[model samples]
Target: MNTTDIIGTIGVSLILIAYFLNIFSLIKKDGNLFYILNIFGGAIACFSSYLIRFWPFVILEGTWAVISVVALLKSIKKPQD
Candidate 1:
């Protein structure tokens, strides 16, 4: 309805889309696109939470974003075949 809600909905939509695709075998869990979706989604969600001064979700989504980044990095460093 408002800016916060709109932003949060978009962020959540991205995350859900990624999950749904993964569940349907449309996207690989370990693939870059999966991680990218999580990274951006978590970041946008975290930002919305910050704008609303919601510390709990700010912490949660911030952690999610950070963890996704770490995962992406690890995947990138894997020895190529």
Candidate 2:
């Protein structure tokens, strides 16, 4: 596989890892690691989509990345107990 494919695979892997961990109760959905993985993975995936000029995935992953960033920011700003 080429570099873009490798990057997309890694990106998708990271996203799936986060989801799997969440489903198995290995990590909290609101945890920093979860959002971090999502943001990075989505960004990488979005970039890969852009490289291939795939508009559908570009929109999907771009929205995912943006939402993840917003969640991360909100989490950081939230008052801890």
Candidate 3:
């Protein structure tokens, strides 16, 4: 449809895919791919939320994106099991 819709859809799709994969044991939560999906998904979702002037979702997705980034860094620094 619109640019906003397209972006939001992609973001949400990534998040959902990650969740689905995790639930089915296809991917580990601590894996880089998981964090990557969340980082991009949350960031894109946050941007779309901001575009729509939705403060709640913007805050939520922004926090999610930031936490994902931190988690990714920590995961990288630490040894993987």
Candidate 4:
């Protein structure tokens, strides 16, 4: 495998590990920011794997990241009792 592929693989792996850890309670899910950032970073790294050749992942990650960030921001701003 090429260096780019290796690097991308590592990045994706790390993100997935982090994601699952959070979900399983091994890591703290303290706030929306963490979720948003991890997903956003994962999506970016996954999309980059396509290396400007195919663009499916680009759209998938882009939409997911945007939605995640928006939802996170909304949650943070909502009034609390």
Candidate 5:
């Protein structure tokens, strides 16, 4: 596979894994790991999409990455129980 394809695959895999973990109750939705996976995955996916000149996915993934980053920051600011 090409570099872009490989990158997109890995990015999508990371995102899907996070979703699967959440659905299976293996990880909390608000957990740092979940946001981390989403941020990285979304950023990678956004890059790949931009490389391909796919505006729709670029927007989608960009938004996803931004939201994940915000969530990550919020999680970090929260005091531990």
Candidate 6:
């Protein structure tokens, strides 16, 4: 596989691990850093797919990444539960 493929694979793997970590509380739900990292990593992975010229992945990841970051930001501005 090419370098792009490897990089994208690593990025995707990180996103999945982060997602499951968040889901299982392996990372604390209230941790801002964790959330930011998750969003950032996911965005990077998704965006990389776009950079590689994959239209469908670009759309899927683009939408999800934006939504994740926006929601996280909004949550930050509001008081915690």
lDDT of each: 0.93, 0.95, 0.95, 0.65, 0.95, 0.73
Candidate 4, residue 19: the lDDT equals 76
Clash counts for the predictions, in order: 0, 0, 0, 0, 0, 0
Angstrom error at residue 35, model 5 = 0.1
Report the lDDT of model 1 for residue 46: 94
* lDDT comparison, 1 vs 2, better candidate: 2
Per-residue lDDT of candidate 3, residues 1-81 (tens digit): 899999999998999999999999999988999999999999999999999999999999999999999999999999756
Off by over 4 Å in 3: none
* lDDT tens digits, residue span 1-81, model 4: 877677567656656766787888876664564665556565666567567555676666556567667767777897866
> Per-residue lDDT tens digits of candidate 5, residues 1-81?
899999999888989999999999999999999999999999999999999999999999989999999999999999999
- Worst lDDT run of 10 residues, candidate 1, spans 9-18
Candidate 3 lands at a TM-score of 0.94
TM-score per candidate? 0.96, 0.96, 0.94, 0.60, 0.95, 0.74
lDDT of 1 by residue, 9-81 (tens): 8888888988999999999999989999999999999999999999999999999889999999999999878
Candidates sorted on TM-score, descending: 2, 1, 5, 3, 6, 4
Task: State the lDDT of candidate 2 residue by residue for 1-81, as single tens digits.
Answer: 999999999888999999999999999999989999999999999999999999999999999989999999999999998
Best by TM-score: 2
lDDT of 5 at 35: 99
Better of 3 and 4 by lDDT: 3
TM-score of 2: 0.96
Candidate 2 — which residues are off by over 4 angstroms? Answer: none
